[model samples]
Target: MPRRPLLRNLALTAQTVGEHVTDDPVLLALQVSRRLPRAVSERAAGLLTRARGAGVVRALGHEMRGEREAALAALEARRGSPVHRADAALGLGRPDLTAALLEAVAPDERGAGWSAAAARLAAHRGDLEEAARLAARHPRNRHLARRMAGERDTFRGVAPSLPTKTGHTPAPGRVLHVLTNSLPHTGSGYAQRSHSILASLRDGGFEVEAVTRPGYPVQIGVPWAAERDVVDGIAYQRLLPARLAQGQAARLQQHAELLAAHVRRTRPALLHTTTHFTNAVAVEAVARAFGIPWVYEVRGQLADTWAAVRGPEALESERYRLFQEREAEAARRADGVVTLGEGMRDRLLAAGVAEDAVVLCPNAVGGAFTAEPEDRDVARARLGWDVPEDAFVVGTVSSLVDYEGLDTLLRAAALLAPRCPELRVHIAGDGVARPGLQALAGRLGIAHLCSFPGRVARADARWHHAALDAFIVPRRDLPVTRSVTPMKTVEASATGRPVVASDLPALAELVDHGRTGLLVPAEDPAALADALARLAADPAERARLGAAGRQWALATRTWEANARRYRELYARLGVTAPVR
Candidate 1:
């Protein structure tokens, strides 16, 4: 039988659920659509609407037969509703709807809003090739494109899949982190890494106070985060309000100052600032004013970030040059630099910063999942996972992005799928690339051979890690990727999973080719496929590699061990006395 139309079924069910439970149709649609059957999903196309409860109910009840005609005609009815028309066209899966929708679009209309709608429809239909094509064509939709590319990786059986339950809250910490956004809201990989490190610090007995870019329904503030009345035995502080306007930088800065002032009043021994946004800079200025030495975790080449936001023209303009100058000045002025890898440290040194001023704290295993095999097995079993005794389950637990190299894994899976039919590829993440990756798998005819677990919680991250025969990091050789360490590589090693990663120099530091894990050429699907085959043929080699990796993690990478390094570095900068 043809695959069920899960997406269609979901739209219908969600529409029904929305009418019964909530007045907000959009949220209901999102909620109900998630539970729809595959067959229903296909037939329920064009159900997409940003409408309120009434509009959604009306749209869902409308006959699918004349919906396309009605949507195209409605384009003429509304003067400035390209978003509505584009959404309709997307739901209906009509390419012709593009022309009609574009006809009414204003010259200044953000083209991306419409493109996002189209991408959504393509993704819903599991047509990632089409989604990627549309996403890339829309130049302003870089984030959309990146998301789609990442989804493509998941479909190709790469990355850790996250489980979507309600949510998983980590234990509270002693240090308070007053900074910008949280996981999903952050625009870049650096932000994600920063959050991960903060969590690690919390694990190491720091009363970590966190206040994300405020004003979200998701109440991730400290008092609420802590199960006990207090967080890390300290009163939580979350005073900053979420910014309402997108372009009001100066206003946001003023609001950020109030929060920074609160931090200053508290005068925590160590004030860690993560991003270069308004809040971070404010915190830094306050710490400097108080004569507090702050640790500046440099995630990116600031010059590169500035260039990415403003076009090449800004490179020569005084404004761009000034931004770069200030960024350099900030680094020079920072007491101690906490960078991701040696590459960042080397760059800072080359820029004439003193070598001793930098401390390299690449993403390390935080000892979250270092339990015994029986404990891991119990965890996996409780989570409803059934691993075959003989199965060589190779998996990844990362975002399914193009840079993460899901395509390479899919291609490798296709080649390995026939030889090692028992070799199941499990992906533990999701993104816009989902449709593309799924399409690639369908094209490669290995769809049935892959298991997608969506997004899993941090609690279950280790079990997923322990279950894998070999953990893989197939990163593309992008400049952003080259400068960063794959956090999962270290996490997987801590779980004692042998790794098969791309042979990048930064990753080479983590994975010793023959000793710790096998290394494959970047983007070379065939090489990745061959490496997996080699590991599958030799279980003894896999076991040896896994053992070596676990030892390396214990000797060099746990967060408690790393946090002391960070504390010592701060002391050298005259920030505080030793923690002991």
Candidate 2:
């Protein structure tokens, strides 16, 4: 094989192995380099002696270390490389420099990288047409261009406007939601939250509609249906094409066009989308076409979430930068912005969104959670926990993902095992990290104390919370975790269970430290263990905290309350519907 292809394959293999084996980027890179043929390795080392070559590697290394300025400096040193120049310029917020460098590169040489960078620059500069044009140059980016256009008029001519309400009392104007995924397919927190929001909106007297993107629930194959179906009383219109062979951009265009047709047929007053920039892009196009305002509900900083999983270097990756820029652009363009918590709102404000434009509609409780709390012993028995009747069960019902810090919980459990011999830890939920967490539990000698009952059905969510004497949110201190308020914590509180969570800003917003729940220092097993031990030792304190938490959740964190907030926000944006 040729050197470039061989090196590329080696790099990919190294990355795959590194991800599966360890978290160290330097080690991963070294492993990749070591796998190269001796001659190739020597040549690679030689290139590093050159300023431009050294600059390239240094930039990547600095980015991985979260050293933004250092990465820029390294990129600056690589003046001969147009790609590095563009990246450095973009990082410094100099779109003029970025565009110049991008334009200087040949189209073929530029490939998808230059196209993506130029498209992002154009979007950042508010040249949606130019952005779309540039994005269309690459197969992977075509979807982004359509999203940038968002039904807005270009040289391509104007899009059709949605029919407006004729009467003062128009039949509750429909609000169509664009989603990445929804119920009867995926069971992630994002999907559940979308279902809750949509249900609440429907019950609030508005005709709410949802359309999921293509290739959803990719893990399970389900036949596509274009016709609208009423699932659990909420109407979902499926728009995914039966056969999708076109590139992502073309698919996005198709989605927008189809959604536009749906909008005309439904004549919704506005559009709404959540989480990702891709969803916003598609909705923006359709909304713009119809001249309808749209709302952008940011559930989490997905870029940060992705970076946290990959490593620090991934934060400064081009993809991460583009994701952030796109999200910022969407937030800037949307008529309203809704986020899950104050921490997320602060981020939006810092990103230049007006304070008044952002609404803090937190995750909330409904369904079984709102019903009277179930007895702990009864709930535990129902879940088939073979524990002593007097044993203290400390557990959490959450997706067993890495950032969730379940390993920390296992470590904490180990520390508390000897002190609180009757302590049992139940982790209810399944994810990629389950095997690793289970292994960690065994290594900590708390495997006997820890129980992984896999994913609990949504219907059984309340019971899962009920079974726990105390719930825990042991999320590590990552930018994403710090900004996101976990719905699990709120749900646990609503179930009248005291929460033991990491002392992060988002959690602090929900759990009133010593009042509603105990807040321990993040990533510190000792602190976590101490808090759990304290809660385990005092039943009266647990009851007191749980009662206060339940009252707080009832007062502030109900889906009804969240719906009301959305209603008020919509009204402010001139979308009015009569109260039922």
Candidate 3:
């Protein structure tokens, strides 16, 4: 909702297109000469002109099976005018045209937006190598595209368009999903993580059911249903309370009782609960009574998360000690531990959990992200951004947190502003830090250059990624960040933009310095500024890093790949695979 962010988004999209055409005087002349209505503002017309004048029109025209001649004619008609031929090409699926436009644009300037188009084109041609290679270059659109390409290339002619519901062998068995916080509202990390896994498990041929938090609100006027709603061909129990409990614990008890009764009736082979809060523990007690195997997925190191939120003073108190002890007990006793990253695995190992019992399973999105040519114009117009297309844009799509290093990045931006006059900084997600960040930017005399797009839809986050010349993860060095894996890093890498990040341990593993991104010392604004400047100044370096990062994600970080790892772990536990 922040005006700065919306304007920033617009600026980024224009900048993305501009990076490719800025150096081409012919293209520039063509763009500016188009005798279109003066009502068409310089910012809006420039974006459309870049898209058309750049190579996408021919590519999209061919793909759409439209008259390439006619499209070309339209483009030529606006040769010196502000026309939207590139937008038309995008609508028509002209990969060649799009690619032509994007060919000269380095990933740093075009960022994820440009690379995603190329990757999709490669995927359509059944070229897994090209798709995987391209997917690796962009940070935002990695997982889904890579999965499709890999599967198609690996299992082509041997397997169906989709992975078989039932593999050669039937799936191990039913895995019930317990949703303690199932409300659509308050979509915290835990909800997204659980939902993604539920889909993956069901797709991987595990019978799945969900019991929502007791007294949880329904999506609409209708109460939640426990029916055969197909989730990857597996049943889902979408339970919502008609009227429910008072406190958090009380709500958990009611949900547990409901789940206990459901388990008695359904007799699932395994009950997997998500998060460290009351939902899983309550259900674990019931599952124990039922003599069923129960698994817990820890999204974060609870003790660390608590400490991060509460500070050291609280950790020294007896209350905090008890809280830590309880979490440790839960983790110790769980049948198996599923975690977000290697950091959590290390934490569990230190906590005396059996190494074999812990699994590294991070959260992810499903489905490939493809760019729509029409999206370029519509999104640009909607956001009202008009910076000349030739600017260097760096962006981050996350809630503004002190831990996220927005403050550090702001300082870095201030430092780099003098040297990189065309550099623009975008902060997409909003949180408690907004006012202070605004104030800081103003004080730094760089308020005019910062774009704060407040909170954005998860789906919309991609556009923010697409608009950037590079994406950043500015997490401060802290115990929590060191032990935690950020979702944005995964999202950013998948999009194919070069990443500039703190040299935190978890991020260190994810971002290979000089390859995927530049890793700066934590909390060092100068280092961050330098890294950003390096990418901004060198187009080739940004492309190299972005391309390398995208490839790594496709090869190693897809949800399907991660799910397979989890499946192998479940097999070790002797859980039978469910029917497809």
Candidate 4:
């Protein structure tokens, strides 16, 4: 919002929008739907559905809008080129079709019309080197070219260096966190964890405050958001600009400048930033300019997360390769790095973060989760959930995404429906995968017994945990799932609910096989169904596992304990508060 950068940003935004609409209307429609009002969403939807002349645009839009079958059917019915059909199929999540369609077209025959699609396919199917070469051929599409490059490439030499502080005095105890989003406005597990960590640090006597990425709550549809919000005594500062700089690279630079100015004003002694290198790129720059220590929290392997939505092939993609490089770069430059689970610690080491510099700070829980849980039926009634008193409910309260593998849960429910007449699968959360999962449930003929009550409130998280007879963490087997520890899993264990999670390394760290909770093979619906059936049939076994899970959670995972560890870590890093 600074007068100096306003004109430049406006011009860039205009250029970006013009290119976006002209070259990639499919993405433009999706972006408008998410960022704009209802009228625009309707218009965008119509543009795709009625874009009869442009087969590629229509097909891509249909797929992105969660109508995969419609997209594929329309593409198949059309008399489009092989590359056109392949692009549509890929967008529809049909890699098999993409392969088949591409098989008919010679590699040398592919021109600019097919180059972008080929680049994406190569990225998904093979290596980045080839994909990057393919992507670079598309001179008109800057976004696609940048997508294949590393995030550091976007902000190359863009870290802002501010002048020496003059406005505020340095307080050793004051730690400012740079985050992508935060509580109230964004109710993601990421946001929840941010608040908990900030609250923990505040309670531990550090003057902790958070600053969300620029244009955060405002851009995410919270038009009424103020500059500051104090939730549970932990203050969150918003950076709402009238408009964001044009593209990702430009926006990151702008965010860094804004953050640098904030550092000048608040003058914290240490900077702490979480995963996904964007936050780090900005924070690291500010920390350097101010000559203060910074901590990078590797909360998740976000590159692998993006790959999950695509397929296993995406593990070798250009985006994945670039993302990992940037993450490693950020982690290596930090004064210290913190991560969840031993799996993630090993990943950090593998990613080139110094072994001695990184520490394990697993996802943990507190407050109501520390106490005895309410009766399952009582919780259901309190939540106004319609269900039989004797029904055996098995579910999870998590963001419904492809990586979470709720489709596998629905499949398991279908398998258990006939035998376990009292069985109910209630998944509570919302994401891009919800609609597809719901459609899959209906297709599996178990929609009658399944209930997806969307996203739950942060305050009602405990109640949702208690409402289930058993908690499920049926995550897919992927690079991300294997490394990143989920917060909901620990919260579920803490709430005295027997957790049935995938046998990934991260989940294995929380669940002690058959003792604390059940661990099934990832993506195995039959294994999941078998485990759930056993729990449903044996009340005593369920009670025993639940109690053990609670004990394990209390002993190993608590924000209070985590806070002590962090306080100690701060001391070791020379970031502790000075004695009054």
Candidate 5:
């Protein structure tokens, strides 16, 4: 996090742009716009426009101009230096090209960049041992070093190292949380859930505070972030450092030190952190230092989520194997386990956690969501989204990721366009997949009826929820989707909108097949279309289902209710915090 020299910053900017220029054009543009000056951006946009063939600068221009395939093609075709060509090939997802480039040189002769590319190629090919060895070759490459050291630390495990105070009494009912990121800066489901939990707990009268990972919002593109922000009455503490350590083990140790200092100052009775092992490492270390109990919430199958994007075969990869091994290790070692639902709870229990240790606190609604939803016409008018009176709107408000299977919704829209002229598609929210999904809708010839209104701000979420007649959760049948419950779907139901979702275990727990909402086979556009068509045709049935769904959410899924359960669970663990 230290201020870099101008030359160093320039070199890093070039390296970063070159690294993602081919496969992730969006990433390249983001980097350019955020890191470079307007003059620099314009120059980059036309750097190699006239000079043809494959080169990083030319590829940068191609990516800047939104020519993805052409940028990748340029990366794949003409190249000079083995390091540059290898990096380009790796970016293009062509490990074979990287292998060919490296074959001409000795391992000792290959420079740092080539070694890094070789390591990535090895990881892509599932050779984790080779990846590790290659990672160690470039000791100065902090990114690879961090990844390498993370695996080592996960195996060695996180434990207490700092000394405890002789006579420091903790606030009896105080609880401290360690988080990766939080609101006003990040608006992902994770951030929203964290805020809801903290806010509800605060309302329930337990003194609660959250500390983000060291160098957080600052690290994530916000350089002017303050040291603390009180969001909805909960204090979100920041541990901003002038510079983060280089390797994962070092960085984790530094984070633990920073948190330990805060823990000493706050003196909380209990510590808490969510899934994925790194957070647990620091929390575990700090909890042990203070001789206090800690709870680890298993939010999702993070390893499965990581592999879900790579492909089915990625489950066999070294990184995936190590990720699960480490996560289970952390979960088992925690003082208590809290999870979303049955699927996730079972995974933790199967991983060696005792049955009595795990508690289910499913995703729920609170605050604004508990209120009655506005009429569709009223909501549409307020949001400035025009819609005909007869139009039947069906789409989801979610993070538009690939695993969400939004393309399936686009295809279903195409199928329903002819028979149901009033059908309209308005899939809200944003992510890397939005551009691709929009293109898919265009290709299917449903672009005229479909609307990709981009990211819907959290404050405006209720309006979007009220504007739709039926909400669709067309998730792909991936391990991640099957286990991870979505917060938006529950919010939709709480808005009195009937839900139509893939027949997955996690989602099945949320929707009561015939009563609250309908569950269709995953990835089946025809089945999804049929379900939506029925809802569109029968206004009464839609009302019945929507009302029933709202009742179910009210009865079972509320942050206030979840907060009560959390207090009960903590009491069982000897965290005798006074609950109002």
Candidate 6:
């Protein structure tokens, strides 16, 4: 026999043995193929990598690593494989593409994999009955069939049931908020917003209860188990099941079940949830099960955030399409929708949500942020910054993400450094992009002028804000940035600091150009430098903008005002709190 043929047979035997011993058939195949001679191994592995049923595994691996573009490319390369194409389509959140891909397969060739993909796609598309029916046709799809059947049974008889008005005493105003994460675990802007809203609701006399799903404080390595804690007078009930943390689908189903049980016990008058499709889906399920009216608070265009990291081409990818679809579906199903800005509300309206259904509850400042201004010199001293009392300080308290345009800020700082030697930039938040940003600062020769204090504690966040002469929000002009407002900007404005931000709709809504803060063209270091230089040069102007900003924030962006808006929204939905 030819050496190649003999090696191929041996490799296949090893693959079969490996598959029997290990659960990962793809890894086994790759491992076995490596036993062949160099040239043969390379050719065989390359062929197997793009094999009919292997694209799903490869794509999933890429997705797990946050390499969305790579995952899509893997699926795109295997377009001829129905299973791969269906898996890709489903992953992208495109049931239509999945259906099309599966339909293109010959009837005889539609086996377990194709049936499983079809079933999952049906389930994702909110067709649990069809999903269950399709899942039953294949033995391998039994688990998925069970889940689909459970979901169907869970909400089978559920419908919203509002109390009829009687002359009897009114029920306590109680709300159950389902969140993606909370304090002492994650402190992203989403978590901060959730924390602020919960606190405001509680202080406003509504009994607020919050619950977070599994795998929260994601990078913190916390165990998967239930936890209870209170922060700033709001209680959080967490359900972090180990199995749920194993996968996204399992997390959603298990979270819904757990949340429904909590809802039954709490008997909240209404359900409230925020951000990302996952939280909305889980809360929507629980709300439906209990027949409770739910509010979907669209915090940010999460799909655009996910796409921002992947690149411009990601907007056209299946994942982006699915994200938008899921968000729109959540909005359509919710009794009311709340968003961060008018721009976002407009986007939701354009996406077909009823004009009245969407409410604008822009990001607001807590008391700690809007308290009487602290002395900047004292704050700087407390924060351990050794600088001249008159030194020009420009800083931001934000997660160092790419879309934040911190690199652009660094470039701007470098440009201003030549003229303003007393200038210093302090960034007080940490994220995946921090290392790259720091490297960029060093490359720009502004490392000496830049200080990254990592993530500041929420309680201490105001101190950092108070230490700045002018606060900056150097965000890029991305879809997410344009539609979504940043909580930091509100916090900065409330701290009585002038904001210098990109000229985008969302920031522009918050910072009235030249009145509240300076507006600079986005992604332009020169423009940002000019703005920073002008602010650094004129203390009177800075004081003027800062004072105006504080007034604006107090009038429109305080948590007290935000709470009133929510109360009104709830009243419109026939859920009202008793007067204090």
lDDT of each: 0.59, 0.74, 0.61, 0.78, 0.79, 0.74
Q: Give RMSD to native, each candidate.
A: 12.8, 12.1, 22.9, 4.6, 4.6, 12.1
Candidate whose TM-score is highest: 5
lDDT of 4 by residue, 121-146 (tens): 77566455565577678676456666
Cα lDDT tens digits for candidate 2, 84-189: 5675466444556677777778866987667767766665554556766877787866544555554223212232233332332223557888888778677778
What order do you get sorting by lDDT, best first? 5, 4, 6, 2, 3, 1
Candidate 3 lDDT: 0.61
lDDT of 1 by residue, 316-379 (tens): 6433444445445556667767777777677677767778887877776654545543344564
Task: For model 6, name the residue pairs that clash.
Answer: none
lDDT (C-alpha) at residue 251 in model 4: 73
Top lDDT hit: 5
RMSD of 1: 12.8
What's the number of clashes in each of the models? 59, 6, 44, 0, 0, 0
lDDT of 6 by residue, 475-501 (tens): 998999998988888889888899999
Which should have the higher lDDT, number 1 or number 5?
Answer: 5
Worst 10 residues of 2 by lDDT: 151-160
TM-scores for the candidates: 0.66, 0.72, 0.64, 0.85, 0.88, 0.72
Model 5 lDDT tens row, 1-580: 4333444334434443433443234334444442454356457667664565446656556544445566566666656566676665565445666788778668678777667777777767666667768877766555674565555554455443666655557888899989999997898899999999998887877899999987777656565566788777778888876666654667788889999889889999999899778899788888887888999998889888877766767888777887888889888999998999889988888899999988899999998899988888899999887778888999988987789999899898888889999999998987656656766776798888988776778999989999999999999999998988989888988999999999999999898998888999999999999999999889899999989999989999999889988898788878765745
- What clash pairs does model 4 have? none
